[model samples]
Every structure is written in C-alpha cells, then in structure tokens.
Target chain A: MNYNWNWGVLFEEQYLNWLISGFGWTISVALSAWCIAIVIGSLVGVGKTVPNKIVRGICATYVEIFRNVPLLVQMFIWYFAVPEMLPEDWGRWMKRDLPNPEFVTAVVALGLYTASRIAEQVRAGIETVPPGLSAAATAHGLSTAQTYRYVLLPISFRIIVPPLTSEFLTVFKNSSLALTIGLLELTAQSQQIAEYTFQGFEAFTAATVIYVCIALVATILMQVLEKYTRIPGYVGKEA
Target chain B: MTDFDFNVIWSSLPFLWQGLQLSLLLTLLSIIGGIVLGTLLALARLSGIAPLAIVAATYVNLIRSVPLILVIFWFYFLVPLALGRPIGGFYSALIAFVLFEAAYYSEIMRAGIQSVKRGQVHAGQSTGLSYWQIQRYVVLPQAFRNMVPILVTQGIILFQDTSLVFVVSLRDFMTASSIVARTEGRLVEMYLFAALVYFVICFSGSMLVRSLKSRMAT
Candidate 1:
C-alpha cells in the first residue's frame, strides 16, 4: 500500500495554536506537581531516616501505599471520587472555587504518588553517606538540624542525583494521566486535535517526539551532573 | 467533614462487586501476556545476537521511558489505523498493558537470567543437555523460582495500572467510583474510598509477594 504524508499539517496556524495552548497547561501541571513532590518527598524521606520510630513507621506506611499503586487510579480517586465525601460547602468550594479542578486534582495525585518514590530516592541518597559524617558534623559544632543541612543533605543530593533525575522523568510522563480528567495537557490536546482533524497518527507522533526529546535532554543533563559530581570511586561507571 | 456513610457503602456494594471483576480480569490477562512477551524479549537480549539485542533494548527503553497512559492511548487510537483491523476495547487495553509490562518484566528477567553464571551453562554441557534443554531444565526453573518475587511485584504494578483503561471508558473500580461521585457530588468521600481500595489491593499484593520471597529464601 502507498501513502501520502503531509508535513505541512504540523506547522499550520491551527495546529501550532493547539501545541502552544496545550504546552502551557502541561508545563503548569508538571511544575506544580513537581513542587508538591519536592516538599512531601523531602519531608518523608528525612522522616524515614529519622531516629524517631513513629516517624519512620509513618513514612514507611506512606511510601508503601503510594509507591505501589498506579497514578491513573490515584488521579481518578482525586478527580471523581473524593469530592463527594467532603462537607457540602467544602465540596461546592472544590467544585467551583478551583479554576481548573482537573489540573489541581491531577497535580495533587501525581505529586503524592511520585513523592513516595522520591522519598525512597532521598533516603537512599542519605544512607549512602558515611555514618560518621553526621556525627563528625555534630561534634564539630553543627546542630542536629545543621548536621543534615550542612553535611548530610548536600552530599546525599549530589550522590542521588541520577536516580532523582529518573524520578523526575517518571513524574513528567505520569503527568499525562491528568488528561483523563480533561485538563487538555499535551497528550489530551493531541488526542483531541487528532479526533477533530482525523490525523491521529500525526498528532500522536508529535506528542511522542516531544516526550522523547524532553526525556533525552533530562537524561543527558543528569549524566553531566554525575560526571561533575563524581565522588572519585563512583565516577565513570557508564550508567 | 461528615461521618462515615453506611448507606452509600451498602448501596454501592453491587457496583463495587462488578468493578472488582473487571479489575481482576484485566490484571490477570495483562500479567500473563506480559510474561510471555517479556520472556521472548529477555531471551532475545540474552542470545548475544547483536541485532536482536538492539531491537529488544530499543523496545524496552522506548516503552519504559514514556508514560503508561501514552502507550495505552497509542493502542486505543492507532491500532485500527495502522493494521486496518478492528479490536475490542478490553483487548486493545490488554495489548497496551502487556506491551508496557513486558518492557519492565523483560528487564527484571534479563538481570535474573544473566546472573546464572557462565559456569552454570558449561556445567550443563557435562550432563549432555542441549542449549535449549539446559535453559529449560537447569536455567529457567531455578531462574523462575528466583524470578517469582520480581514477577509478583510487577504483577501488583500491572494490577494497579489496570485503572488506565478507565481513560477509554472501561468501567474499572476507579471509574465506577467517579460515576458515583458525579451523581452524589461528594468528591472527597468518593476519592478517599477509591484510594482505600487501591491501598488495600496493592498493599496486600505486596505483602503476599514479600512473604513468598522470604519463603523462597528459606
């Protein structure tokens, strides 16, 4: 079978508009969810490593529940099922006050889920440090809080940079599930445009390329960081 | 926040039951299909055949790097267009989940299979078994036993990901809860319940897998 290809369709004004508008929503969702992930994951990751037994248990519970479940299911639970249980006024507030509840719900769910994995990454990073490092900081006039801030966290963050970058990519891809709630992000926009234009392959191909490019750039950046941050023994392992 | 709604729970029982069926069916078929495809891909990679390894690696990296939803949508939207064939919604989704899951499982199996040591293969030669026989009798059985925990872990992941089929309007438990939420107008309650279901399913599956791993170790 023979087929004709239309490269012009991609650069047309209408398709460009869709791409621009869709990217705006996509970036907003990704950034917001990423922020949430950073906050929750940092806290829980530290919590898991804390001396307090209760805090460690709580963090473990959180990680197990969220990390093992699917992002799509979590998004659904946030978008469709959760509001019904809210108090009447609060429920109405969630439905009406949120400018785009779809975006908000997606961010919250995806962020929380990704945060669990990030928590593990953070913990792994922290544990990778020598045990006496924190003690040395404490003995050398660093407070308990200062010990982590000054000595533990900085080194751990550098060490875990590669896995942390992978976590970010995972979160980025997962943000597309927000489309199911009708947020009109990149994936949703492409699908909608494809439906309207009947150029399904073209629209999805663009989406695929964009995703691949973003991931490639992120992976390269991570490798560079790893090289620069090389802690002598760990450098040049060809990850 | 209002108290627990016993009435809603009682009324939604049958709907929840139906959703359970769909979730189970999707989870089982996807895991099985994934295992078959993943084994083939793993074998191809381990074969040390350059082209086959390249193809297998490409498949794993491409799918694993993308979002699961994109894979699902790719199958939903592009299958009929590419093949000129009509497929059912369930099968379309099964295909997507299988393809995605295979990428993960293949990687896991590849690691497990490779760690069997080169000496183990030569040892099989002393017994006079063919290469395929060695794989089936000596390699795969032990590999599969050790492979069970990873398989179980991947299985739990696939079970949870079955919710992605909801994007195409398949009434899985999560979708069913959303429909209930729309009618009831209680977002938090419905969602919390949905999360509860996911937590229970995944947590129990993981616990089972962990115990099985320990049992195997013994």
Candidate 2:
C-alpha cells in the first residue's frame, strides 16, 4: 500500500526509446521465426504424409522431440549446448564469431520449436481433407507430387487458417522467451524499465497494453484473411 | 572439444532430483487451482447475467493476450508492493501460473459444457431439479469426461511452463540445471540431459492423451 506509482516514467525519453527498441526486437524475432516455422513446418508436415516409412518416421520424431521439449530448455540448448557439439572451428565461430549470437540463436530456437507445432497443425489439415480428392486426382493421371502440389496443399492451408492464426499469435507471445537468452524484447524491456524506475506496476501495465494491442490487431487481420480464403460450404463457414 | 563428462550428472543427481520435485509440485498445484477457478469463470460466462458474462470474457481474453512471463513479473514485483510485504518467488509464481492458466482452462471447460445436449438440461429441469443440482448431478460429470484428454494435454503444457519460474530465480529443474551447468562448467552435458528428461516425461504424457482421445472417439 505504500509503493509509489509513476506512470510518467514510461514516457521519459530514455525509457520510451527502450520500449520502442524492445518492441522492434519482438516483432523482428517473431516474424523471422514465423517465416522459418511456416516453411519448414509445411515441408515436415508434408513429409509426415509421404509414402516412405522412413521419411514419415523421421518427420514424426522431429515433431515429437521439438514439440515435447520446453522452449526455454531448447533456447539454452541452442545458445549454450549445440555450439559446442559442432566441430571445433564451427563451434568457435558459433560461440565467438557469429554476429548477434543471442538474436540469431533466439530466432533459430523459437522458429524450430514453433515449427513442430505448426507441422502438427498442417498434418491435421492434410489428413482432414477428403480422401476422394486425392483419389480423383490420381484417377485423373496426376502424379502424386502433382496431386499434393496442385490439390492437397491449397485446400489444407485454407482449412487450417484459424488454427494457424492462433499459432501465429503464439509465436509473438513466445518471442518473450528471447529475453532468457539475452535478446531484449518487449517483456525484457518492461522489466528493465521497472528496475530503473522502481515503478514495476506502470512498466508491466504498459507492456500488457502493447501485447493486447498486438494480439487484437493480429486477430483482426487473420479474420480478414480467413474471410477471403473461406471455402464455399466448408464446415467452418457457418460457424 | 573437451571430453564429455557423465560423472558430473551422476554427482548432481540429488540437486537435480530436488529441482524436479519443485517443478512437479508447482505444476500439480497450478493445475488444481487453474481448473477450479476456470470452472467458475466458465459458469460466469455462461450465466445469463450480462455484466458477469462480459467481465468473464474480458478477463479470459486479456490474460490470453499477454505472455506468461509478464504476468509472472507482475505478481513477483507488484503484488508484494501492493500488499506491503513480499510473498517470495515460489508463491508469486504459483499465483501467476494459476491465473494465467485459468484463462485457457476456462475456454476448454466452456466447450465441454456446451457440447452436452440442451435437451439434457431440459430433462433435468422437467425433473424439478434446481439449476445447481442439475449442473452438479447431470452436466458436469459428462463435461469432465469429455474434457479429460484436453485437460491432460494442458497439464503437460503447464508442466513445461513451470520452468519459466527460472526468471524469478526459483530453483526449478531448468534453473537447477543451469546452475549446475554454470558451476560445474558442463553446459553441454547438463542442458542436453535436462532436455532429454523433459522429452521423456512430456512425450509420454502426450502419448497417454493420444490414447485417451482415440478411446473417446471409439
């Protein structure tokens, strides 16, 4: 009951700059990781459905390992453990010569973790597609690759937009974990502001507001994308 | 590369086990607390009262919007200041996890409740049962059964999240591993071992949920 509250400290020049830069890092990390996630996730997802048993097993193992491990642990492994596991010169380069090691390590860790989740979604999306479509594509003399490329992926991607949107939102939120490895994203910046000013409540409130705003905007944008991509008479359309 | 050391892990077994116990304790307590509070929030949202529903919905959405780390920070730093005394890291982290996970648990509970047929409620009504009686004797049993797989899945995620208490310097498993890694200079061995332990527990948990889901479907 005796603590002082100073909301104004958040707007002071130095604090404001920290928040801005922190916000910048958060967005950059999330977006870059998202790009990696979607691309790799889709491929791994498609790999899970391939005819080769070994390929499917490999894909399944990837999803299990990445998805099961905690993101914070994974971050540490990437930042501290993986480098040393590499050959001597490469390990040295990773530890000492890599530019922005913290940032790069964070992006790679977050991306790989999110990729596993997204791969699961993508796999579900593909599996839920009517088997008749694939059968018909083959009946039309389409190669398996052609069938998947031209028929399966487009419909599966549309079917999964809603789940994908939530996962996208999650990546942004999970980007906060970057602070664990020394990347000063929004959450880290807010904590720093709280430390410097002794105004913990105001600092956290500002961070919360910014995060909520980001989620709202992202939700709205994804809704719009969902609307544009709606499949006529699909299950989600009425809902 | 320096020779890998299995001896360090064997030596630190007691410390690691202590940390693992704390992580499981936090996860267990938070899951219980989250489900209890979440069930109430679900009821409030489904209640006919407009303000109650809106407030419940807003709470769920707002909490869902932010990272758990920020909420953990809020409780760790601000709650003590507001209350005029520190509650220490463990309690603050526990409170934060409970509140944060409740938002997610509420949505799951709401879906489970809604999945029950409306006719079931009407059947209870025709039997002259009170609303609370109807919910208690009829709806909730079915809802809980329907939600078991999802609840377990969420519990697994909550277990993973308990490691985030490292931010407050609480000696959970992840933090314990990091501490030993630092002091013993065995970052590679310690962290990889930590990851392997988590993988085994969580991967098996998910496998259990998967079997449960399949059984439900059958």
| Top-lDDT candidate index | 2
User: Whose DockQ is greatest here?
Assistant: 2
Give the least accurate 10-residue stretch of model 2 chain A, judged by summed lDDT. A230-239
RMSD of each: 2.9, 0.9
How do the residues A1-239 of candidate 2 rate in per-residue lDDT, one tens digit apiece?
77776888999999999999999999999999999999999999999998899999999999999989999999999999988898999999998899999999999999999999999999999999999999999999999899899999999999999999999899999999999999999999999999989888899999999999999999999999999988888746555
Model 2, runs deviating above 4 Å = none
Q: Give chain B TM-scores in order.
A: 0.92, 0.98
The reply for model 1, stretches above 4 Å from the true place, is A1-7, A80-94, A130-143, A234-239, B1-4, B82-85, B184-186, B213-218
Query: Could you tell me the TM-score of chain A in candidate 1?
Result: 0.89
- Model 2 per-residue lDDT tens digits across residues B1-218: 76899899999999999999999999999999999899999989998899999999999999999999999998998678767888788888999999999999999999989988999999999999999998899988899999999999999999999989988899999999999999999999999999999999999999999999999999
Candidate 1: share of reference interface contacts reproduced: 0.65
Cand. 2: chain B TM-score: 0.98
